[model samples]
Target: MNKFAALCLILCAAPANAHPHIFINAGLVFVVDADNRLTHVQVTWEYDELYSLLVTEDMGIDADYDGVLSEADTARLTGFDMQWIEGYNGDLVGTLAGQNLTLSAPTAPTATLTEGKIVTTHLRAVSGAPQINGTLSFLPYDGTYYTAYDVTLPVLVQGGNGCEVTVDTPDIKGALSMTKAEIGALPEDFDMEAAGLGDIGRRFATDVRVTCAAL
Candidate 1:
């Protein structure tokens, strides 16, 4: 498989059920410098228990059924190559001042099983420091609809002077309806790749808008 396909398999493999195979409750922490310029974003994803079990079993972790995957287990699992595909626009999208913000490669990726759930965290640095004068919008989703993203926490802004943040979550129902309608309008034999299925999910994703007050 190609690099993009391999990465998609881990995160966006479509099942026959017409619904997402994995469900993720996600949260974001926006890291800013003292000058109120965005620096990095910390993302946390919590997976459902069923998916967690599948991941543990597939990765050959929790060998003794001890409920906890060892440090080695965590390391091995985290070692999966998740680097951004060069031509692929990643699942996470961000914009500031209506201009797209480039998110660099992910760092400090960690995965752990806790309370029957798998939680992972990764930090991605913004390519450049962009001051958030008004609103910063984010959408996280797998375009194939193979994975669903639901924001579980407010957007946290850390280390920005005089910056207060408010998170506005989009309506899931409305977004879902929009995606379904768009997909349904396609021809029965429509080619997914040609139709850009890999970029469709964002249209239905719940937006995470971080609006800040004047500094």
Candidate 2:
């Protein structure tokens, strides 16, 4: 929790050499027909883009989603999302089908954890028309490459209805845990003029992806 607060303070300052930790909240609604199959998804990942210092650098270390895992990479994850989180031109790999989604290393966003590797937190899937809000970070690595995602998403979680998870195993890497008041109470200087964050933190949902998930 203290770390989360510190992150907010640093972001409010927008220091140098810091990665942009941002939340490009997308409203994802998985649609299915009478049968269980992925039909459509309403994605809106571009909302109230802010200067998340962490989002800028942490997600950039491994342009490749292979998760061999790296200690050095974890160190670099610090002080990220404090500046300007940029945008990219890529898409998440996993597929979502009728109340369920699939995640795998060989697929799009299984998240292997090596220098460029990822991990399989292993949990995916949800119940009918679940309301989803996620973030995307534009992170570049080795000073020239980049990637994006909602590091917040977990592998396995209690079904939104509080039932034990049967399928859709969730991976909890980098999925921070905090309370709503804790996050909202974190110190921040939402002055787009002072922080120079453009339209950030101005109109609630219009600027950042909030309100829905936490409620």
Candidate 3:
């Protein structure tokens, strides 16, 4: 199922001069094993009320028309984990020791409607997770900027000791403005691949880094 399209039903609402039709408040919790190797990332995405309303109407969440999410409502929406499609990496990119970490299918996925908002949580296993030594960083963003992820929670380092985590919200205002200008200047028939602006979304991401002292 195309979760992105499902979440974004009102495509025409997107501004013509910019992207992000929907807004999400995201939180991340880093999971590590006893050996201090990164194992998984627990992600919580709280969607805006408007998109949540769309989900309830379109995804059959409020099946009973009760205006409340029940166990059955959440059960029906289980396994709604967004999948990588058409070169889209679900807007989350992780790296360990400067090497990209491959992400597996999300596990323990769940969804609920609370206070007129849709909240989803899942665990993304870190395939080939490196032993934590210096840094583990992640960049979350949508390539087309269809959804803006605002990560508000502090990165939690769990099941590991002597580790320090810091979040760097890089100043991307200049770079992103430049990228938008470049994209706007492109000819209608120009190929983005030829222009090499394909990962332009990364310029607007918040960088989360984890560093630990010697174990």
Candidate 4:
């Protein structure tokens, strides 16, 4: 084709030529203290995608996607560890009761973009308000009957623009450990509401507001 036609083709093929999947709900953020150590993270997910993976074709914790996980699903999830979690949090708060993650952060935070550049990101949220089921928890020994506390809370989350986070799956042999990142920078195709290859655990933030709480 002519020069102009060839240029048009290049632009048209750009979007698909890069990323593999059509991400819907995915995002990433990095919180570094004065010491440069990575702090906490906030992730929000696409219910449909999550349900499809954990649950079945629209069936996981809440098998029917009716806002509430099935009794059997909840029962089976007890004390079970979720493998291959990329941005998985350690402190859980909403489990053992078979309900949506209700992580209510006592406080929020105010945000400020540091550098004038695109901060690569890969982030998401697991549980928040308007959600009815599917959450993680912590198991503690009571010296008799163990107790699980749900830590799926919505703390004040912050992020920068022009950021992207990505997953680097090394082709090394042995145990293929999933080492996905959502901090220290932005992602390759970080759109805040879209997921890409191998970022199945990535959740995007919804109604992302970084205002200080009035508490």
Best by lDDT: 1
Q: Per-prediction TM-score, please?
A: 0.80, 0.24, 0.83, 0.24
lDDT of 2 by residue, 1-215 (tens): 34444445533334333333443333333333333232333332331223322332456653443433366655554323222234421233322222223222211122223232222211123223334332211111111101123323222222232112122212212211222223355345434344333322211221111111322
| Alpha-carbon local distance difference test for all models | 0.73, 0.29, 0.72, 0.28
Name the top TM-score candidate: 3
Runs with alpha carbons beyond 4 Å of true place in candidate 1: 1-18, 81-84, 178-182, 191-198
Q: What is the per-residue lDDT of model 1 for residues 27-121, given as tens digits with 9 covering 90 to 100?
A: 98999887778999998888888988887888788877777877798888673536567855557889997899998778899887788787888
Error of 2 at 192 (Å): 36
Off by over 4 Å in 4: 1-24, 34-36, 40-42, 47-54, 57-65, 70-82, 85-215
Better of 2 and 3 by TM-score: 3
RMSD of each: 4.8, 16.0, 4.7, 19.8
How well does candidate 3 match the true structure in TM-score terms?
0.83
Ranking according to TM-score, highest score first? 3, 1, 4, 2
| CA lDDT for candidate 1 | 0.73
Tell me how far the alpha carbon of residue 85 in candidate 3 is from the true structure, in angstroms, after superposition: 4.2
lDDT of 2 at 74: 51
Q: Runs in model 2 with CA error above 4 Å? A: 1-18, 49-90, 96-148, 151-215
